[model samples]
Target: MKDVVDRIRESPKLPNPYHIGEICVLLPKDNPDLRGKAGYWGVVSHVGDYSCTVQTWDGDYTVKIEHLKLLELLDEDCQFMQQLCVRLRQLHQVASRDSSVDWLLQGLGKQAKPYLSSLQAKLLAAVEREYKLVWKQPKQN
Candidate 1:
């Protein structure tokens, strides 16, 4: 009787590449298309096989982990940013009160539509200022 042996080959697994909303750097040493984009940072919007899609200042791109570096923000700054986000969310809840406003939105309650709009604009501006991106509003009829 001949002896037979079976061997299973298992490939090493990589950890999670990145989380959504994470800011990562691009190292374009090998890709000519990203040659000058090495220094810029982008937000990781989606992750794929050995690659991730990021939204940058100029555009979005799918890059590999080898060419992506995670940005480590200071603890204090990170905490502050988190708090700012929470505050902005609270500010957004202000919109629910809009339904009870006067016909022209200049009513006795809801702080008036104009004031509420101003508050939202300010909150959105703060978020944009910290994140270096603008919140584009949908077109109105």
Candidate 2:
């Protein structure tokens, strides 16, 4: 969708895993398949010219550049979108409280209405909880 594309374009450019901290894992393309899936989320431990090593929550693995699709990166974007969706929903609820504000909420409600679908909600919640963001303080910092 154009909206999705616009959102992706607006997203901050994620730095390569190499610059991240120790826990970052460069997920392997062979042992695991992370394409369009929400399960694989990790940090990059090391990066060579052609491949990168990642230290995942379960273990460490090396991945080649070609196989390193943007699945997890897209997942990260979804995570952010989830947060925004939540905020928008909260705003809608607040707007509903006052009759005058209801008009404004009507427009926002239409845009966010799709996310409220039961199936999509369930899947989003599951992915959110599964690949939940885990912030790790840098050892040196």
- Candidate with the greatest lDDT versus the true structure: 1
Error of 2 at 130 (Å): 20
Clashing pairs in 2: 24-43, 24-44, 25-43, 25-44, 25-54, 25-55, 26-54
Error of 2 at 84 (Å): 21
The digit string of per-residue lDDT tens for model 1 on 110-129 reads 12111235665564566445
TM-score of each: 0.47, 0.29
Which parts of model 1 have CA positions greater than 4 angstroms off?
1-9, 74-141
Worst 10 residues of 2 by lDDT: 106-115
The Cα local distance difference test for each model comes to 0.54, 0.42
Across 1-141, the per-residue lDDT of candidate 2 in tens digits comes to 999999998988655544333222223445455433223334455777666664433334566655444333344444443343343344433422445334433333233222355654454344334444232322542
Q: After aligning candidate 1 to the native by TM-score, how far in Å is the CA of 16 from where it should be?
A: 3.1
Q: Count of backbone clashes for each model?
A: 0, 7
